[model samples]
Target chain A: MDCYETRMEPGDRLILCSDGVTQAGLGQKRYKFGWRRSGELEFAQNIIRKSPEISAKDLAYAIAFQALSISPEKCTDDISCLVIYLRHPRVLRILTGPPYHKEHDHDFAMLASGGANDVIICGGTTASIIERELHTKVEIDLNLMKASGDLPPPGMMPGIGLTTEGILTLSKVCTVLEKKQQDKIPLAAKAIINRIMENDCIEFIVGTKVNEAHQDPNLPLELELRRNIIKRLAIILERDYRKKVTVNYY
Target chain B: MKKITLEICCGTTCYMLGTQKLLQIENIMPEEWKNCVAVSAIPCLNNCTSENICGAPFVRINGEIMSHASVESIFNRIRELLPGEGEE
Candidate 1:
């Protein structure tokens, strides 16, 4: 195999494909008399030129779909196209539950204010602590709350990405992530899941505080401990979605 | 009776001005009018031009644009449009 090296800047795209794509439409009537075998390279280049903002995944799909469409009636070799776009990794920090010790609240808030590109505060008490320590008001969207159905609406803080109710929202997120049911997820959970999908790295700051309300027999079975839910979420994100996940406890 | 759809603009300009206060319309609305009005928040309505920016907070009552919208103004407009009222 010949080796070549090139520097890839942000927003640059690199495409690799199997020979099947290049050899596609070879025996078709349009190319029967021509020396050129296929139009795959020109087709992909045209698609790339047409859509400057097209994602790597979409570009690959577009190329592969074109190859398939060129020879729809015949059984051909496996056609695969992989496109890699170079960009900075996006980091999402999720702050959930309150710390076991009250003294750690300030430290937690300080950590939240650190350099993560996106920050989602998950619990009501957790948000209050951040608001008190960061001196930023958390405005709960009443309109979103009403539209959220059973779940509480998300909130907006000055610098934070999203603020939501803790346990219930996380539980719904876990359910949505596990079941892959996008249509049935609540509004707040949908927002969280959307952010999770957009970012490449996920950092979870879980507080060890145990809420006694969750232990009540009257509570639903899915209302597990905060840490347990976070663990499940991290597992699903890492194992299934192949995301980089880190869990830190305060 | 057809319920009146009230969409409040929660875009950046409107939110900064006062959409948060107007969002509480559902909680503070009179019980009698609750059945007739349906309030929801939507993204920018593209009404924040140089001419309309001063009226940052805007709302739409049954697709009619209302600039400089407030709880009281919305109520008065809804009162005017309610069935058996002006209906226009």
Candidate 2:
């Protein structure tokens, strides 16, 4: 973040964004959310409309929040901004990231552990991992943790990279569960099937290397294996969702 | 009555990794377990991937960490935690 300057007029609406907004990852190229002030204004309007009843302060916060939420790795630079209600919008100046911790009320830990809806399962290798990591019997804690926001969010994982495959996988899986429950599938069956499927997936998946390796020579076998696993998952997801799954290597 | 709370981080990596589906875990809960569990969304927890290209999109369960997670794993973990749920 560069500087926070503001000039208040009667009904001037202002908007600001961090360097991250301009540095979004588009393959090797970096791009801004919007190029021009008009476009930025429209982006602001979209942000305002994203959530109803949000005040201007919260709206600005959400814009920043959502931008960062795009990808942790993608946001190399810090983001700082100051929007003023002036006759016309102005950049003032753009800053990179925050200097120090201000009010991140939406702490990552709180969201990961105590979010609105969550599921915790215990079985097979996954159960073993949970037991090993948390040092508790998977059987006892799975349900307890699922029912309670006693855990962290998915991003806390150690390795896995954020990829299109991962995103689609999440969407597809959520769709399956939502539909299954709506159709009154037996909880036991759902759990059993889910456990069987999830146990095969490696935790802390590192997709960036795999993504890069696909194009570059000397790809590691481990990276290839991860890609294959994700591909299989995508196929299963496609079957589950009855849609064509697209996997982006990059 | 056992009280439980689950927070799903909708962070970029988490969202991409299918943590979004964790948001729907509530629907699958048997009526009996509903009252005991609470779910919500969170921002960031500073849990980074070993390699930005490789790691990310993790989750924590009951103060326990589950990194590089997936929807299937998350679902499985939740089923084990819910009351009267899990493999027989």
Candidate 3:
């Protein structure tokens, strides 16, 4: 075995593979291009180049799958690929609920827009505050909510990472984290959970405002206060997931 | 009555290019065609690369790829698919 070492900078990706991937499609008539075989290396490079944001595990799967797909009839070797993506630690800031006092709406909006790499605004009213203060529009595509099961659709705004309905989405996030049943979570909650898992530091801006609609007895018992839900999320993220969490209530 | 599925790409590359405006397509869609269209935002279509990143803001209409997509262009394609009365 030959060993080599090189300096890797942040945002660099390292891929290690077995001979199966490199030698795939060798001597195959379909892969013949003059004298060269259209091997898995080319296919892996194409997948990586096209989907630069792909996770390391997904990259490995793609490379191995490509190797298997090429000349599956004569596949005799075991294919293996390992990918390591190096990057700086990321911080995710989540803004949920609305400020208790209407006077602090601008303050809440400014904090949200203040240079966070990943920002998630949960709650329609919370999003509206940001939209009003930042002069940006939050567009919620109702069609995406078809499978969300009573949860309002997710919204998108310029310069914000993610926007979604509050309490319900947070409840789903908590459920998915505790039960590990990601398949049953709604799309918006799934997106939020995915973002949370990817980051090292989590900062939550928990607005203290209480929506009277949630207090109705007709609603599900799980529809608790936003502050309580965020507290639960912070606990799970910090204690269970070992992430650095900071929650500031306005 | 089958509705045409329209998936607007909201990936970082596509959003920066102009998909943000396309998210409002529902607002401007013809009232008669509203029932026939289903629109959603997808994270990425994986059609973008360093070489062809300029062709971003892509959308899928009934699983068919449409690059350099705009709300107007999407409406045109939907018209071709549905061809409602009085629509050119």
Q: For candidate 2, give the DockQ.
A: 0.05
Q: Candidate 2's residue-wise lDDT over A174-243, tens digit each?
A: 4454355444333333332343343322222222232231222222222223445445545664566343
Candidate 3 chain A, run of 10 with poorest lDDT: A32-41
Model 1 accuracy (lDDT, Cα): 0.77
Summed backbone clashes in each candidate are 0, 73, 0
- Per-residue lDDT value at A128 in model 1: 72
Runs off by more than 4 Å, candidate 1: A1-11, A15-82, A218-222, B1-28, B31-88
lDDT of each: 0.77, 0.41, 0.75
TM-score of the first chain alone, every candidate:
0.72, 0.25, 0.81
Task: Give residue A57's lDDT in candidate 2 (0 to 100).
Answer: 59
TM-score of each: 0.58, 0.28, 0.64
Give the lowest summed-lDDT range of ten residues in model 1 chain A: A213-222
The DockQ assigned to candidate 1 is 0.05
Query: Which prediction has the highest lDDT against the true structure?
Result: 1
Model 2, position A122, has a per-residue lDDT of 16
Over the stretch B4-85, how does candidate 2's per-residue lDDT look in tens digits?
A: 6565544334544455456566676568756866655544334544344244455677666676666567657767886677
All candidates in order of lDDT, best leading: 1, 3, 2
